[model samples]
Target: MTKLTCFKAYDIRGRLGDELNADIVYRIGRAFGQFLKPTTIVVGGDVRLTSKELKSAVTNGLLDSGVNVIDLGEVGTEEIYFATSFLKADGGIEVTASHNPMDYNGLKLVREGSRPISADTGLADIQRLAEENNFPAVTQRGVYKQQSVLGEYVEHLLSYINLDNLKPMKLVINSGNGAAGHVIDAIEAQFKARRVPVEFIKVHNNPDGTFPHGIPNPLLHENRQDTIDAVLANKADMGIAFDGDFDRCFLFDETAQFIEGYYIVGLLGQAFLQKHKGAKIIYDPRLIWNTIKLVEENGGEAVMSKSGHSFIKEKMRAIDAIYGGEMSAHHYFRDFNYCDSGMIPWLLVMELVCTTGKTLGQLVNDSIDTYPSPGEINSKLADAKTAIARVRAAYEKDAVSVDETDGISIEYPTWRFNLRSSNTEPVVRLNLETRGDKKLMTEKTEEILALLRQ
Candidate 1:
């Protein structure tokens, strides 16, 4: 039996061939089928060169275990979630590495209603089944069928936003040559039919596994400038960018100022609460988000969950929350099976701007000012645990509160910071935020880094 190194606490991801391959993926399919015992499974893949081959291997394994596969080829991750719930599939899997580097690819799995399958869920069972190399035998193999769910997906997404009163606007969209381009055409077709009066200036809007415009991740400061430049040059109202699989999106205002995901969370939370008063909203505790304050102020309940896609989705389902958002730009919808949709966040934000007669900049500016954040910083530490412990000891005395839900989150009256070890690499991630105090945030960030180094 071949060993798998990249099976993390949640999904399976690693450099191609070294940690994942056709044979191992085949075994994973059998393992997943054996674990879930689903009658029908929805499978989809991104534009990565390896995705098709991996999907084939996974399908064979599922068939061998007597589980029928509905293949939605070359679709985004959220589309699989849409198909699973719409088609009433027993489970689903999306073959994607998300915004990881070009050399890596992997799988995101879920069960009925698009519920996530994580380490605490069925991932451990799948891992055990894969490691044992013994899959369930069946008398007959299940069938495979190919379908395109993009049209239905677009319609489903539009249902969340009011298209009736959307005003005339020009927007810049950079797909980064990822999987988003294929579906953007469908969405644009619908917008045109409805006469939304929005002109889309597209850049790098092609599905290329080679990533000619570099990786599609906008969280990196250097990668966001192209979209910002396009927005400024075209004089567009806003700019939207997608990650590799288009499962998360990042936005820039009319002036090309990058709108932080934290502010977007608050903005979207407010939008949702307007219609569903007193609805529950879930957020991750990576930063001291003013989104919680905004939600509470608006007569809605705010619940904090641990970070990560799997954790947020699970909590959303458990609490029956109306919306769930992460500071990293992942927004999960109750309608979209509570799975994160990189496509819908921007659409809803556009609707918010159009209906409210405010620019994206105006909607987020106040919140950004209220809770300034240091932005996530990653450090390649010699030992993550030791570094975290040293920082914790240094701040323990002054911290008004300390919690290790995700990592070491130390809170002071004016500022707070969360330092957690990365699941996939030997690095520690630090996220700090303040109550309108930028200098203090910077000073405390430096102080924590210095202590970690010592």
Candidate 2:
């Protein structure tokens, strides 16, 4: 039996030839079909060059296993999530490597109701079955069909905001030549039909699998310059950018300054709390102060979950949370079957902008000032564990409280920080926040970085 290195903690991600391929992907589809035994499944792919071939292979495997497949041709990851529940499909899969390098490709899977299938929730078992490569012969093959849920998906997104409330605004949307362009186009059409006054300035809007603008990952500062420049040139109200699969969308304000995802969490939390009072909100442990304060002040319960989509989704489902967000730019909604969407967050945030009669910067600047942070800082060290231990030992002695939910979080009255090591690499991530004290945040961040590096 061969071990599949593509099976990651949450999804399948790996190099194309050596780790992931059409053959291995077919095995995964068969294995998934066998594991869940779902009668019907939905499948889709991103704008990667290999995505179509891999999607076809996986669909064939699923069909051979007696699972009918509804193929959503050339869509973003969230489209699969939406179609799974909308079509009442028993399962769904998206062949996407997201922001990974060009030579890599991956898959994201979900069970009924679009619940994620991660390591703890049938991923490991699927991996085992695929590795075993032992399957009973199929007597009856399942049907295969192609469909587009673009209309329904766009309407669902628009449901979050009122069309009449939208003011005249010009926004820059940079798809980075990924799968998000089509969805943006559909939304723009809806806006025009409804006579909404939002004008979209598209940048890198075409879905070129070659990723002419460097891989569609706006998280990298180097890749964000185009979106920022477009925002500045147009003097747009806001700027939005997405990765290859469009599962995560980054934002910029009128000044073309990138707004940290940490503050977006607070902004979105407040937006939901406005309508869904007394609702529960879930957030990750990496960054907390701003979100917790916003939720609590707005008469909502704030729950902390371990970082990662699976963990956050599970916690959101268990707690019946109205909304959940991560500093990494992933947002989950209860209305959307508790699934994370890169599309929903911006819509909700834009709604907030119009209703409050505030600029995007005005909406988030207060939180940034009150809870100063450097966002998430990553450092590569050979001995990540030892470095984490070193920082914890140094801080725990003087800390008021220590939390080990995902990693180790040390808290003081005015400042708190969480340190977690990468599950697959020699990288340590640090997220620190100060209670209205930028100087203290900077000083402490430097001090902790020094200790971890040492």
Candidate 3:
């Protein structure tokens, strides 16, 4: 039996040659088919150089396993989530690395209804089956067919906002040479047809497996300059940049200031609450006060879940949350089967900006001012657990309240912070915020970092 290092806690991801290849991917597909016993499944890939080949391998394995395959060629991860529920497929897998390095590739899986299939939800079984490489003979081979879900997917995205209310706005969309270009083009065509006065200034909008611009991850400060520069040069109303698979999107204001994902989460929650009063909004535990305050002020309930895609989606499903968001820029909508979409967020925000007569900066200024946070900061340590414990011990005693919802969220009267180890690395992530005092927030953030480092 061969142990697969590619199988991760959340999904499958690995370096190109040694960890993941066609053979391993094929076994994974067969194992998934066997585990789920699905009659049909949807499969797609990102713009990575190896994604197409790997996607084919997985699709072939599914077919050989007597599971019909619906191939949606070259799509963002959210599209797979959308298609799985949209087409009523039994399951879906997207071949993507999703902000990983050039040599790494991975898979994102979802069961029926586009619900996540992570470690707790049968991924372990699939991994075991793949490792064993033992399978019963197939009585019948499943059929394979290629189709385009772009039109329907585009229409579904349009459903998230009012077309008529989208006023004249100049926008900078940086696809980072990934899979987002096609969808943006499709949406642009729609805008043209509807006579919507939205103009797009495309930057690295073409899909290039080479990733000449960078890895398409907006989280990295160095990777964001092109988008920011484009927005400024074009004087666009807003700027949007997507990750490799486009699952998460980062935003920029008209003034070319990058908006933190934390504020985006709060803004999105407030928008959803405005639309459906008393709606439930799910947020991650890393940062909460801003989102919670917004939710309360808008006649909504805010719920906190562990900080991850699977956890957020699971909690959203459990509580029937109208919308959910993570400070990492992943936005979820109930209308989209509780799946996160990078595309949907920007559109909704655009509508919110135009209709509310506010600039992109204005929409988030108050939230940032009210509950100021420096966003998530990471500190690599020799012992991440010890570092986390040290920070908790230093503050928990004086904390007015402490909640270990995700890691350890400690709150005082005027300030709060969450310190936890990374899911995949030996690093402690610290998120600190203050009550309208950037100085105090900065002070506490530095204080926590010092403790974590010590």
TM-score each candidate: 0.97, 0.98, 0.98
Prediction 3 global C-alpha lDDT: 0.91
User: For residues 211-259, what per-residue lDDT tens digits would candidate 3 score against the true structure?
Assistant: 9998999999999999899998998999999999998999999998999
Q: What tens-digit string does per-residue lDDT give for candidate 2 at 1-454?
A: 9999999889999999989998999999899999999999999999999999999999988998999999999999899999999999999999999999999999999999999999999999999999998988987899999999999999999998778788999999999999999999999998999899999999999999999889988889999999999999999999999989888899999999999888898889999999989999999998898899999999999999988888888898888999999999989999988988899998988888899999999988899999999888999998888889988888899899999998999999999999998664568999999999999999999999999999
Listed per model in order, the count of residue pairs whose N, CA or C atoms clash below 3 Å is 0, 0, 0
Residue pairs in candidate 3 whose N, alpha carbon or C atoms collide under 3 angstroms: none
Candidate 1 to truth, TM:
0.97
Query: Please, what is the whole-model Cα lDDT of each candidate in the order they appear?
Result: 0.88, 0.92, 0.91
Single out the weakest 10-residue window by summed lDDT for candidate 2. Answer: 421-430
Q: How many angstroms is residue 141 displaced in model 3 relative to the true structure, after the best TM-score fit?
A: 1.6
Q: Show pairs that collide, candidate 1.
A: none
Best by lDDT: 2
Model 2 misplaced regions, further than 4 Å: none
